[model samples]
Every structure is written in C-alpha cells, then in structure tokens.
Target: MADYTTAARPYAKAVFELAQETSQFDSWSGRLQFWAALVSHPDMSERLAAPGLTHQDRATMIEKVVGDEMDEHSRNFIRLLSENNRLPLLPDIAAIYEELRAEAEGEIEATVTSAFELTDSQRDSIIGALSRRLERNVRIVNVVDKDLIGGAIIRAGDLVIDGSLRGRVENMERAVVN
Candidate 1:
C-alpha cells in the first residue's frame, strides 16, 4: 500500500504542475473531482475495468460525460489516464493533489469529535485555538459521538489531543493500577 502511494506521487505532482502552469488548477480540480466521482461509481468502475472494453471506448465515455464541464488540459489528462489504463487511480491522485493544494495554502484539516454537535461559536473557538497551536489555518470537520460522554478529541495529521471524558477515565484507571 505504501508502494502504491509512492508510485502515485509522481503522477499526482505532474498533474498538479500542469494545472498550475496553465492557470487551470481550480478548473482541473473541479473536473477531476467530477471524473473521480464518475470513475468511482459501481457501473463506471465495472465498465472501466472490463477486459473487453477498449481504451478508446473508455476515453469516449469519459469525454461524453465531462467534455462540456472540463477544460482541454483536464480532458487531455483524463485521456492520458485512460490510454495508460490508470483511470482507476484517479481518486488517489485527486486526493494527493488536494493535499498538495491545501499545504500550499497553509491550511490543515482537523477532525473534532465530541459528545454532542458543537455550536457555531464553539466550533469557531476550537478552530481559533487549533490555528494558534498549529500556526496554520485550521479546517475543522466536526463529528458527534455520544459515547465520548463529554469534551472533544482533536486530530490533525500525526497529532491527536484526546481530551474526551473517556480518555480521562482511562488515564485514571492506568494511574490507579500503577
């Protein structure tokens, strides 16, 4: 799995550079998102992987669906992927490209899980605190898990701040046993 991600890095970088060079990054982003969704569809994935389907036919289907929505560069990129039998890898590529884009913009994704849904003000406060701690713009994705009982957990990249009631209880148990 790591090997696959390593192999995909070059392709993802090349596409991102191409988009940046042509000033089509946003357009490509939108189009690739569309293509990624289409490619992931059960019907389309089956069609794309069928041994009987020719590369040209796959390209044709892609063009038919997104031709009007995408720029020429993106369409050509898709054609190249189809021609090289790499359509199935578009999702990973798109994800990597988005990661690069976000990093470039000094933004990081943080997942916040709490016992209840956070109010807008609470969410904003959390984002502010995380931004100060991370020294980067924080994008919060909030989730509610009643099992958490109280407080919230924050995960950003390799850092996880477990402030939930469950974590505190576990820590207390460990201390008593020690």
Candidate 2:
C-alpha cells in the first residue's frame, strides 16, 4: 500500500498554520475529523472509487452531505483535495493534524496495554511518571490483553516499554536458546 503520510504532511501543515493564524485550532480539528470519518466510511469509499464522477461532482456530493457543518474556508479545502485527487488522504491528514495540534499544546497521548485494567491510583501513578519523564502533559489510553500475564506495556510516541510478563519470559527464552 502507498504511504499517504508523506503526501498528507503538506496539507496537514498548511491547515495547521491556517488554524494557528486564525486561532481556530479546535474548529479545524473538528472539521478535519468529521471529513476524515465521512471519507473513511466503507460506503463513501466505494462511491468515491466509482468511475465517471468528475472532481467537482465528488466535492459537491461531500459538501451536500456535510451541509452547514462546513464553512466557506472548509468547503474550499475540500474542493482543493478533490481537484488534486487527495480526498482519500483525509484520514492521514487528520491524524497528522492532530499530532501537530498535540505538539503545539505540549501534550502527548500514551497507550498502556496490560493483563488487567488499572485502578485509578495505578493510572494516576503511571501518568505522573510519564509526565515527569517526558516533561509534558500525558494522556493515557488503557488496553487490556490477558496474554500479557502481568505488568504492562507502555507506549508513548516513539518510546515503547515492554514490562509485561510475557515479554520477559520471551526474552529469557531467547537468552537461554542463544
């Protein structure tokens, strides 16, 4: 599959700059998310892939569905994507836009996968540790995987810490084999 992030970066940066200039970051975030979800729907994807629809036709269909939710600037953005055949990159654009937004706001989202759900105190402790280590506000998303057996695996951006029992056991097995 093609890597859409490289193509989506320019669009995401442009939109982010516009949002920053206008102090409309939240507004643009919502708009991008809505458009991304719409375009990512299976039905919409199928329709968009169908032949014979002109770029204008595709943009108009999306605009009609979006209705009053989109302002003039947003509609124009959609048109530009349609004209450039970049409509399918909306998801990547939105995701990149969010990452930009988070960076600007000095925040990072982390995910913790564990054998069991974390208690409120445990969650708070993890958040505190990550915040202190990263020197940024941290938000965690918890995922439970029983196969982990114990402990947890924490992922924050490029950093991943695998403290799960399953991971430790695997490492020990590898060491023994070697």
Instruction: Name the candidate that leads on TM-score.
Output: 2
Candidate 2 on 39-78: residue-level lDDT in tens?
9999998898789999999999899999987788898999
Q: Pick the lDDT winner.
A: 2
The local distance difference test score of each candidate is 0.84, 0.94
**For model 2, the run of ten residues with the poorest summed lDDT:** 1-10
- The Cα error of candidate 1 at residue 37, in Å, is 0.6
Predicted candidate 1: what Cα RMSD to the true structure? 2.1
Query: What would the per-residue lDDT of candidate 1 be over residues 102-166, giving only the tens digit for each residue?
Result: 77778999999999999999989999998999889999999999999999999987889999999
TM-score for each predicted model, relative to the true structure: 0.87, 0.94
